[model samples]
Target: MKQTTCRIRCVNALVLAGVIATTLAACSADPGATPTTEPTTAESTSPIDRFLTPTESVPPTAYPSATNSEQVANNVVSWYESGGEEQITGVRDRSKEIYSHHAEDNWSIDFSLFFDRSKEAQEYPPIPDRKTQAAWSTALKHVRSGASDIYMSNQLGIVRGSKEVKREAHGWKELAQGVKGLKAIEARLHREFGLDPLTSP
Candidate 1:
């Protein structure tokens, strides 16, 4: 009876050991069964990733297009006669608003080239006569000067107050005269050259 009881005790110990081995093998085979700790703050977030992501930026305005002299002259006349006037007036109307941030951006892009006499000659076709050429030159200078005054006034933060107000009004007056001068010059050149004016779109 004692021998039988001892054999039975050994068998029971072996069965218990086998059960433990099976459980260990199952855990090893299925790693996903184990619970994982949450990631540390440093692992979950990175300053470089947060701040270095690429972002869209504003593009520079395209320069006005004109390949030849006649085209350049026509472009200048069209811009001054219509586009420039509309842009300046729009900006003036919106000067008191928050959304007028880029009010003076168009001046340099559209009109600056005409102010450079050498550049103007190189880019534009020759006017038919000395008289018309003189008129053209004067008109460009006036327009450039007037535009500069307006641009500078905005740049210098002279938007309000009585003195600055008067200065801005004066600038507007000069700009109007410049526009009128440009119109007259355009007409003379068109008549002299027999070139048709570009129709406003």
Candidate 2:
């Protein structure tokens, strides 16, 4: 009886060892069953990921698309170039139309400069109704000569304007600037104003 009991106990020990070994081997072989290290609950996220994650980022519905700055500036330049009063007026009107299309917090800096020039042109001559050819010439010269400077200034101004517009526009500008293959005026637009001039139809 003692020998039989001892033999039974040895068999039970062997069976337990075999069960444990098989379990470990199966766990290793089965990817789903394998034990995995859990990620820490306090893991950090990237700056970009944090920016992308949506929250209560409510921006104004009337927020104007900041894309029209350069175009409006060019149009103003076109106006001055037309030389014909009717055509110049038409160009100015079109520029106003472009400016009016979106709800800008204020006119873009370049656009504002153009507007001020136009206003000054309207106010030319001491008489309330008299027109001055000299004013027209001066306005055109100021606008044309300062085109590059105005563009650069406006590009930076748009970036400043964007801060007051909406959160999405602000964030879009930040991301678009980081994108590859953007530089010069195009990059400036994307970076400063969130306008993708290259891909827009």
Q: Model 1 Cα RMSD, Å?
A: 17.9
lDDT of 2 at 30: 78
Per-model C-alpha lDDT, please? 0.50, 0.40
Residue 189 of model 2 has an lDDT of 34
| lDDT by residue for model 1 (59-167), tens | 2123356576676566544543433333333322222121122344432333333334323332454343446556655655555555555556655444556765566
Off by over 4 Å in 2: 34-201
Give candidate 2's error at residue 66 in angstroms.
35
Error of 2 at 121 (Å): 33
The weakest ten consecutive residues by lDDT in model 1 span 92-101
How many residue pairs collide in each prediction? 2, 0
